[model samples]
Target: MTRQFTGCLLSRQWRDVAGGVAIDLWFATAEEPLCAHVTGEQSVFFLSADQWPQAEVLLAGERGFTSSEPGLRDFSRRPVRALYFPAHRQAREAARRLLEAGLEPLEADLNPADRYLMERFITGAATLEGTVERAGGHLVMRSPRLRPADYRPALRIASIDIETAMAGLELYSIAVHGTGPGGAEERRVFLRGPGTGQAEVQAFPTDREVLTAFLTWLAAFDPDVITGWNVINFDLRFLQRLADRLGVPLKLGRDGRPPHWRPLDDDGERHALQVTGRLVIDGPEWLRAAFYRFESFALDNVAKELLGEGKLLHGPERGEEIGRLFREDRERLVDYNLRDCELVSWILEKTGLIQFCLARSNLTGLAADRSGGSVAAFDFLYLPRLHRRGFVAPVAASTAPDAPGGFVLDSRPGLYRHVLVLDFKSLYPSIIRTFNIDPLGLVLAADPALPEGASVPGFRGVRFAREGHLLPDLIERLWAQRDAAKAADDAPLSQAIKIIMNAFYGVLGSPGCRFFDPRLATSITLRGHEILNRTRDRIEAAGHTVIYGDTDSVFVWIEEAEDDPAAEAVGRELERTLNAWWRETLAAEFSVESRLELEFETHYRRFLMPTVRGSEKGSKKRYAGLVADDNGDDRLVFKGLENVRSDWTRLARQVQEELYGRIFRDEPWQDWLRAEVAAVRAGERDDQLVYRKRLRRRLDDYQRNVPPHVQAARLAV
Candidate 1:
């Protein structure tokens, strides 16, 4: 491995480690290693592999020993692909595991998807040995826990992409960046490949041989992670193939050897990868999983949305412009490639993806790419240990709602007799503010007035700000500001702030977020459930009702009946009265700023907060009713509906959304369904929607299973 960052273990430490990207082990029999007191990496080696068996147990508890394959003598001499399970077996097992865990798994795989998946499983399973040891289980392996924080090589890294000529025969440019904090230290740059009409950063080099020398020089910065858009699928593969044909070692060493990646299953899911020693963050895949929605997650679009500026190259212009720059102007081409890396890096800085992945793996024993639970890994190494300690996890909660659920009012489509919408312009943030909720703030805000550092009221077991709490305080400030904003109708500012505020919780919830703490998420959601239920009760006592709510908005009905001529006047008065009532009642009672202002969002003549679809019980996230939107269309939308969820297909979302919209408006649907289904059966609708999961990996590894969506993706290729 090229000189990489190790938090504490100096190159001179003369010790070996037990874990690697696929498998690594270091042996140091010293009773006390150096630098043990540090928070993370400093702690790993000093504690010694044998001494910190507790930590090792936590990790090993999740993975099992790979049964050695028979007739595979001279393992080191076998092809890298021949080592573990076959592609089809891995894919099938992945699907089975996901289904068992209640996560709807995507079918089949393509090149990138398969490679990334394999990488995911391989690296994922390797850790099971250590986790098994750390969790107070058996001594499956002796090594340091591959905690993400310790694994973070550098805050500043680079992403390289290339466009070549003559079918993988020539050189091209590369991009570099460092994503997280301490970004200033990182630089984005690229080198040019030989092509038509290009000037040299240095003198021109002929053949792929000279280009390899340049890559060696570029390798010095010692990047923490190197990423790309589709560099693995297209660029790296080409480079490797080119180098191999030339009889030279492609020693652009970051990881011990070439990185491993997997393609998606049939029906074209996505791609993912894992560099052995180095972290390889893929821009396209990470952005999609982060919920960045756009027509295309191309370099330009994502970069523009993330950074204020993107590559000068635009849609159609990218190819000709890049090719020309490579052939004609090498410097600009390098600059363009570098700029692309910067764009990706900047977005990642703002979005804590790497942090989340680490936190997630640490928390629930799930890989970011894991669609299925590591049941054997969990049961053998984890559950027993936790059970012994008087801790037992509840089964996965039913997604369906319970009786007397959140929704309690009846409504319809029309001009609201009087509708008051209570919106927490950023509910969680507002709550943070109103209640002064923050991780760090919890400690500061903790009342010396109260003894024993009591937990926040209405919160179950969450002590206020402690030595290391940031999100709580962040949520608090935003929450408070949102309350004040709602009181004054700062619509634009509120919306912007609200979007960011809501997003914070999401990022935090994601395992990919660095701040991923189940406690933090639990603190927010469980408390939210507590607070919301109480708020509803208060509203009901006042004779108004919470008709519907999703995350932040609370729909309400306030009676306002008057003589025909004064009907409009009465409606306005009722809205005003209810708004005032909510603000005062909540403030005097709960001390939470009631962001309950009536928004003239829509006039629902009729709305049904359905009983959980199959049961006559109250529903939580599902409902369907009529709304006369301002656009003059009466829409009957579904809430807590099963059809619009992630497991459902694009077809399902479309069918449900349209069906309800037409149903509420009392429009004809028979013809539409007939035509659509017929077209689908005739294979005419094949092109309508193709599931393209976002991942970063090569495009070849997908060979066997072929789902329709994956086939559609192949068409794009």
Candidate 2:
């Protein structure tokens, strides 16, 4: 029988087959999972027609051969001759050989599977038309023709948590809270033997039985997305190890395939699990990628912060306590396990993290489960469009660029009153919009045929064309969408858009990106330097004392202001005049309408740009201020201070906070300082004196200069 189906592309892979490359795709449909097999697709890349002769000799023994045509053209309008391969391996081999032979191969770095979908504009959603066949008692769509489809199905999600003892490599319990088909809620726990839990618990006779039961339950539930707090590194890894020890095949995939574990390249520090037809999302990683900030990312802490609830035990002995609960209070242990699952699910729902991931994937063609794909996302969105615009992206540069950092002015140190902070809204993105600083524009400006007045002049011998560029328009659209998202109070979507916009310059600067060029990134940043310095000058000339300036903000000191209202008025006036100055300046000089928007960000009633520890020089990025909140309550804000540094002990931070608070409030701080000193001398501050620092490297790797944390880690090990 033949049929048509639509679903989200859950997973995709390709392998070399007998005749050609076979594409294996897994889709999550509303009713059921669909396995599709596509055959006879060849792997391909492009090269210049002149370079084909050398390429043929380089790839002599390769099974795949080049295409019999020279059709595509590159950015320089050079003809991009076609090269095809029978399989992915041959394509990769040919690319390596061509590179070794000093031939430039365009778009050869893309994965075969990705090239297949992205070339056809297929992102996460897909549709298929195929003939049905029976394979090993399961239905398979044979030789399916796939296309990009708009799919927004309600996905089935599972919140999973597991408890185990690391010392013995023992599996204690596997708890899952998920929604089944038809929106039915399912909660179950597969525990090891000797557990007298409630009806939701299924006790297993052995370790192997526990793993088996968990897999069976997972298959039965068949969740589209599995979410957990560190599930990949901890829970799934434990399950895989347990299954290996018991010599049992842990079939966790949608179609009873064993979970494929790919250890991360970070020296086995992280792992990624590929479950066919499902997404495995880690809560902590996903939240971090979405720019979620918390004092602590621990499951209990995050749950308490977000949902007003936390783990069963909030004490420091959680690990020991979980094991204790398992031995003495099995019912309580089961409840705790199930509560964790519920909390993770609730967190995901409240944060709208999944929604943001889907939105980002749809926008950038990245996998929904992928994290930290800033460069990849930028390339995905820009490359296809660039190709259509007659540009083949340049290969990654071998060396890193020496781009100037953001402009930071020398702060006039000392505590002052009524300081107004005026900030340029989205400065780099605004600069791109106004000046048209873009990669393609750089190329266009260099063309001799272009008119002298057709481009805007940039710093360090850079110029951008007046028309037909990519980044400025892309940023403008994203900026508008972000504003809309902010107006609608959609924090996740707003944050995702903000991160993408902010990463454009960085991606261009990064040597890892294919379009990396010093000129492209330097133009944006150096233009920013000019804008900031000139804005400060304009503000200072407007009869206000410019105390300090950073990349996009200027701090103006107003004399004898009694309250926030007066300071705010001064800020608004400065913002208006500076924006007008920039508008007139850019229009008169470059004939480009300014998109620079100077926004009044803060009215600090009492502000302090602190000095270096023992010197009179003011700190670069550290400051503190007193401001009034929306409710008219006075609040103290600290930046780049010991109060915000995690490496500082709690006692030190507390001392700084109390000292600063007293000073800012005009209260006597000498007595408070004396009392703190007395407490420290009397050993009453011992608990707060423990310094906590993150160990960023392996203990063994710290050879020449071992920090205290490294020593501590070594001791612990």
Candidate 3:
């Protein structure tokens, strides 16, 4: 009997079977974990019909390969034919032969497993329909039919941390804290020593025994996600090395398969771990990907910042402390190790990072654990749409013309009161929606066969099709979803949609993306340039003074307004006026409806647009403002200033904040500044004088005239 179920895709892999390649997809459903075996799928790539003659001769004797016309055309409008192979290896080999023979192959580098999902528009969630057979603890689906579905799995997460000797050669203990999905909570530590009387602590006589026990417990618990601070590079890598020395397999996968470890770069200092049916996510990596910024990514620091608690032990001497605890205080060592594991779990829970990851995956069709694949995500969303439009994208260009960036209006520097900030909501996305900017649109618009009114003029002598474009409609859909997410108070989903929607412009602008074209990027940015300039002119004509404008926001001095509410009222009027003007103007001029929306974002009672540090010229991005809260309390906000910069010394930042606050509030500041300088000169503020900066390169790599921080680093080394 056939069964239908929805499951969230956890992992995917492909293997060469007897007759063809079989894609093994593991999923976490509401009921249980399951594996689906999809066979009889061919690995395919496309080639220009004109080049098929030479390609046919090159692959004439190749077995298990066939060629056919699939009614697809390349970006250059040339008819393309698909080359199919029973296995990925065979297809890759044929593509290599064709390349060596000086024939270009299209979409040859795409992974077969990724292609299967992308073509079906399947992201992380899918609905499966097929025959199911129960295995020991899981089920196996044979040749399931899969389609995209909205599903969020309740995954079991294990936060694991290992304590080793200072040199990292000897393992002392391994701690595991499991949460979610499973009914029972798990907190256990396996230490390499005599058993402790504590219920959560288990001790073994040898390192191998401890490792074996930990592995056994882990396999039994079966977490879908294994997380910790730098877990992949430090904990997992150390365990793999120790396991190799102890002649034991590090079976971390649900299928009892060892993780596949691969170096990420030529340096080999960093590695990526792939476990079958499980995700190994490092806490810091995913946090950064979610746009969390911190002074440091140390587990203790992050835990303190996010959870208001930190590790049991902290500081540079933590390693030594662990060692001492291992020899003299095993129980304390176990507690410390377990605390670290718990801290990782707490951090993840506090930030809702797992939910954010799932939301991002649902939007981008990327692996939930994957980070920094904006280009890949773009491909996943765009390629299928392009295919349906009867076109295939060209490979990423090796080189493309650099596109101009956003327009920053020249500032009229001054300290002023009642300055209101107006912002264009999602400016680039709104422009995309208004202009129908798309790769397929750009290509189709250039065809003379297209009707005259169906095309709109773009920058750099390019045109865009008014209809049959995908990006505009896609953005519209996401924009509506984001609105709904906001209304429902789902911050993670809203943030995910925002990040993906904002990434569309950058993806088109980047040469790394297959759909990248200079015309497409410039059309958006140059149009923005036009919009900003015109908006500035209109604002100035309305008797308000425009002090500064950067990219999407404009600062206006409302001279007629005396208080914050009055300034905000003026801002609201301007917003409505400009929005209506844009709608009418775009419809009249470009014969298109405008999605442009200008919003009154903030009202600053006092604002400062500072000049260059040593010049009278107005600075572009540096500014400060005082905003009054609803409670009638004034708060100082800084941008591109020392008070907000991470590299600046605390002394400078504190002084700047105090000085700015006093100046904005019209309070006495001269006496305070003199006293502060005197205190600093007298060594009273010496602790605040130390500059905290991160070194981006090795100390020895600094050659030429080095910066002060680099010099200090070299001296310390």
Best-performing candidate as measured by TM-score: 3
Index of the highest-lDDT prediction: 3
| lDDT of model 3 at position 307 | 85
Error of 2 at 205 (Å): 1.2
Regarding TM-score, does 1 or 2 come out ahead?
A: 2
Off by over 4 Å in 3: 182-184, 630-632
TM-score of 2: 0.93
Worst 10 residues of 3 by lDDT: 692-701
Q: Looking at candidate 1, what is the lDDT of residue 247?
A: 69
Clashing pairs in 2: none
lDDT of 1: 0.45
TM-score against truth, every candidate: 0.43, 0.93, 0.97
lDDT of 3 at 543: 99
Clashing pairs in 3: none
Worst 10 residues of 2 by lDDT: 68-77
For candidate 2, what's the RMSD? 2.8
Worst 10 residues of 1 by lDDT: 37-46
Error of 3 at 214 (Å): 1.8
- Estimate the lDDT of model 2: 0.83
